[model samples]
Target: MPWDLRDGEPVIDPAQVRALLREQHPDLAHMPLGEPVRGWDNTMVRLGERLALRLPRHAQAETLLDREAAWLPRLASQLAGLPSGTPHHAIPAIPTPVRTGVPRTGYPFRWAVVPWVEGTPAVHVPLEVRDAYAPNLAATLRGLHQPAPEDAPASAFRGIGLADIEDRFARRWDALAGGLGRERRDQLAEVWRRAVNAAPYAGPRVWLHGDPHPNNTVLAGVGPGPMASSPVLVDFGDLCAGDPASDLGSALLHFSPYGREAFMAAYDAGQVPDPALWARAQGWAVNYALIFAAQSPGEALRPLGRGLLA
Candidate 1:
């Protein structure tokens, strides 16, 4: 039976996915299918050993998947062209789609088959463990933050000036009043204010992973220590072109107070230091934390939201 159905969304099941595969991609139809892993926008099921099927669970996600299909390949090719041993080359992987699935009778949305990246979600890793990879994360973002073409997608909710989202932030802030104490709320409010007042990014619009929260990052490794794990960014559904700070702010989610310092240091060494950019990044952190805290309090990200606020 279909589960977690939203308004105007269709019921998706293993059988339906298999049917889609059989219809569109006959060769892979025989491959084993794993249980569905549902995200906010998409439902993913592992297809055999090498690839996974990414299908939209909601109407809005259909466009997101389309965006990923259209853009990730270009980004991957750009990364591939970088010289080896460069900071950009250090990025382990970007899950570009190998095959695409068009919408058919039952499945109304386009989907994709991408290489199954192996790693533990950064959220599942200990903060101390994640701390080791702070510089790695910095390198990953540095590699990705290139000038985007004019036609590159833009988002109203992200990659824009903090002042633009002031009203949206105010609404989320009000909603958080009941759950957060005065002190914490005030702290967040102050951060948001600074972010809004800070000088906006004057640089060219750069490609952003869009939603680079802890959950979206995968820490791939075998043993312990700093050398063991590498951060692999995933879920480009929110991918867009915007201010690099929009992506840089995610360091707060992946790090503690000390780890954040390391991230900034490494990032600063690579790019020209900008105080306002960091301030705006902090504001973006506040914005993401508020979303986790206010919109999904019952979910796992609530603790993460509070921790970021702290």
Candidate 2:
């Protein structure tokens, strides 16, 4: 199959990735091995050994892949729960492995090879197992904030400002909140504005996952043992270290009130961003959901951005 649907959206062509693997890794010689391990961004496959071939999924991720290529090597000494570092900075631009023999050079968009992690998808794991990971992830964030070796990219910290977040937030609010009563929108905007204008996240910034939602975490389950939430926080593509609140939005930024509660329950004593800053997070989410919402025809889903209006 060339593509698979996720949350009702078509992800990408698996054949595209397979072709990419074949073109780059002639050594494989079309060996019949297994299926394409799936995720939102890249096509992943586990090799025979404890290694895996992770291929980048898009041109945008190239920016992220570039960051990973540079950052992972530095963090490897410090990080304990991730797969190996990304082999190259950009896909197609660099020749790297896809599966065993699949190389990523001479391809269309960005791609790379990363050691496959040993873990199960977090959604498959029980909440009890997932909860155990909160602290480790918190520590992981704490660690990422540690200074890099000085040469990391500018995005290493979330350079986005509260004003930047708010400007985007206002634009999205104008677009989606237009349907709601003006008084309501203005009131919420005022609350969101004050929340943004007043909160304090003054500590020096540090590198962050940009997002740490469940989709990115891997929980391992060995034999009959309970699931292990030894979080493998991959997808360093969005890694930035601005106000820590930019990352906090990933928790409640995308959820409905009820959903946000359930999602937030996972983070015990985690940092909470200001609602206004979160409004900015919503701004980012609005851009995200709009891309897909515009892709086919689901105007309704765009309002989903208003989930941040609170």
TM-score of every prediction relative to native: 0.91, 0.60
Compare the candidates by TM-score and give the number of the best one. Answer: 1
Clash count per candidate = 0, 10
lDDT of 1 by residue, 116-172 (tens): 877677887778877888888887788788778899999987788888888887887
lDDT of each: 0.81, 0.50
Candidate 2: list runs displaced more than 4 Å: 1-33, 37-40, 78-106, 118-120, 123-133, 156-159, 178-191, 199-201, 222-228, 252-310
Indicate the TM-score of model 1.
Answer: 0.91
Global lDDT of model 2: 0.50
- Highest lDDT among the candidates is held by which one? 1
What would the per-residue lDDT of candidate 2 be over residues 1-310, giving only the tens digit for each residue? 2124434332434455457656765554354434665555666665444444565555554556666666565555444433344221111111123333222434444555565566775545545555555545544444555443445555622545665555555565556666657786676666555555655555565556776555566655553244443566656667655665556555343344544454444333345634544555443444343232333233323333333342
